[model samples]
Target: MPETTIKGPVLVTGGTGFLGSHMVDALLEQGVAVRCLVRKTSNLRWLPEDKIELAYGEITDRASLDRAMVGIKSVVHSAAITMTEDHDEYYRVNETGTKDLVKAAMNHAPDLDRFLLVSSLTAAGPTSRDYARTEEDREEPTSLYGKSKLAGERALQKINPPFDWTIVRPGAIYGPRDPALMKLYGMVEKGSVVRVRGPSQLVSLIHVSDLVEGLIEALTNPIAVGKLYHQAHPEPITWDDVADYCAEALGKRTTKISVPRTLLPAVAKGAGLWASINRRQNPLAKDRLDDLLQ
Candidate 1:
């Protein structure tokens, strides 16, 4: 993090995602050349084509990853999916995908030194309202996605490839061009706010810039190697706090509604059933909803 501790030509797996695009820009700003791995049909509007090299690959496909691994010295794996009703899909992408990527790195990119895995705070599960979660905490993930991410971390640790690997767990990353925050702000614009009630009274949030800085630290800091770090703002912000802030900023009174916690599991199940009957993606899987409640 201290003025170019990491070298150039880094490969980012999820270049098209909101956070991934911010990372690409941050790396490029430091004069580190970046290569983005994305599918053929991926939208390139977030970043310009001239600033980065493109490697067409999917994490589920080993051969494609192998092709992308060539000549890449450091890897910042940011590719992941957050939406879907199926646990199998989450396992396949978040868990198995990480395994395949690490395997490919071991087999193909022998020269690769710094491997950074971008995980989530959900992997650590919920903490008491007054406590801050730490890396030493045992992983009791609330959602299937969290479980898969924790599994990925375990896989990387077990593999223990001949390289300096670091795992980073970020919390509630929000910033420009983020759709979820946009929706929240839009709700604020309309003088309405909604959030799920949870067991924990506090929430952790880190802006995209701060999250990207932590990621760069993971890449450059020698102490970060072989360690797991939780990268989140120290301050705690709750759902009500977010709503109140938006309302105060916009000079409008806000109507805040907290959904009843008891209905979440049933709603999730009903949504799953509806999705199956309609052959569509479920908005919230039961496991995910349960995680939210926690």
Candidate 2:
């Protein structure tokens, strides 16, 4: 598709989310017309209703997706179930929902310029000792969430839709409104930092701002079509580094506490049990713990 044909509003899924909200703000800053596919029950505090259009819908509903795609020239698929108590919910929402969204685009958005899938580093799983993963990596998703995300990617690949498409796997994202890192900050403020007992675990991380910029580039840059890219900070860091930064930022002294890896399974199991009993998502559920350990 020609760049000129991509002039219509860009449709963003998950626009109400942490990362997606930043994506919408960035696109608005660039003077791009933006349309958000949001659930009627979604919180619209992050979205400026006067600036962008809202198409009330859920990703799993094909009819809603079709309605959202009307006059849409591009799509940024950022909506997904990241943390849920139900295992099958991951497959239903992340994998099957993604397939439904893609099919909607194929059926409705005839002039679609780009379809960008926002995935996670978990989709590629862990890398070998001292080695970083590349685009050619053999994905070995350790958790159901990771597996579901990989299945979503396959939805695009196996279907091979007519429209140009790109996939971007972003590393752990941290920025304002991110609750994931708030635990670390809280721990640091309490004069303690926690880590698992093991060899130094290296992980990729990117600020939400940088990740959003990369996603926008991948969606707009012609070279990104039919390509997969890993978006993360160039340097890898350990949990200690993150804690140290948090301590420094807070101007506080902190002590490091390392829990034995042997205790992880018990902790995860307990968390899972509690979640099941309460019918609520647990922060340290087994599957999420597996992803965290990696």
Candidate 3:
């Protein structure tokens, strides 16, 4: 790790989230003081309150963000709503919230050394070309979530600021404590046969630990400033391999049943309906199924 003068305290917007918490841990390991901006209702169970400064705020509230950005030299903007009560809420939180943060950061911390945006690979859209997508590829987001995230990336680029900005687009991030991968883990643990849709689909992924290192590298590296980088493990694994690995990790047999592409839409619709009736969010929403099928 490159050493630097303690310019000012770093602020992480979603410091309590899985990725955000891991980033915070990495920053603390580097002996950097962190100030976390979290909403009043957001869960803070993963964070150590005594060791870091806590700023009570929400991304949707500009005034709250303005207050949080004070004395902060750098920011890791990660407070995005993945699943929401309403579909349009994704745009409100992901796109508009990002613009608000960029404006606030420029206003309060114009001399900020680094502004790292934790964006998803989904922003680059679907790829059936059997290759890992790079930063040079054109963004053709297929879903509302992807479009919103891509919009946020565009918003950040359009910002007129003097600070160094880097966008880290991470592929499907998975590791211990990842709620997004919990459903797959549960299925593997229950000895349930996993169904692979588009078994030949090649997708890139990165362990959360490796992703943290990439984020830290982008913080001060001049090559990363004003550039978008795709962060993933060197190997791109097939969907079937992902299932097999998860099963092997859980000490279970991977009896993979391949689901036909034609039947996926119906299955996803049924899953969505079941989740709606049960008042629970389904990870296998239509867009997610589409992503898998692609």
Q: Which portions of model 3 miss their true places by more than 4 Å? A: 1-6, 196-198, 258-263, 277-279
TM-score of 2: 0.93
lDDT of 2 by residue, 1-294 (tens): 623233458999999999999999988888889999999989998999999999998988889999999878889999999887789999998999899999998998999889999999899997655788888979988999999999999998999999999999998899997877887889888998778987757778999989988887787778888999998988778877888888999999999889999998898788878888988678797788778777
Single out the weakest 10-residue window by summed lDDT for candidate 2: 1-10
lDDT (Cα) of model 3: 0.81
Candidate with the greatest lDDT versus the true structure: 2
- Model 3 per-residue lDDT tens digits across residues 195-231: 6555477777899999988888888677777899888
TM-score of each prediction: 0.91, 0.93, 0.90
- Pairwise TM-score winner, candidates 1 and 3: 1
Each model's backbone clash number = 0, 0, 0
Per-residue alpha-carbon lDDT of candidate 1 for residues 1-294, written as tens digits (9 for 90 to 100): 343467668989988999999999989888888989999889899987898899998999999999998888899999987768666888888888898999888888878879999999999997667677788877788788888889888889989989889999998888898877787789999987866755435678889999999899889988888999998888877767867876887798888767777776787788889999998666777766666556
Error of 1 at 174 (Å): 0.8
Worst 10 residues of 3 by lDDT: 1-10
Q: Which residue pairs in candidate 1 collide?
A: none
In candidate 1, position 288 carries an lDDT of 63
Top candidate when judged by TM-score against the true structure? 2
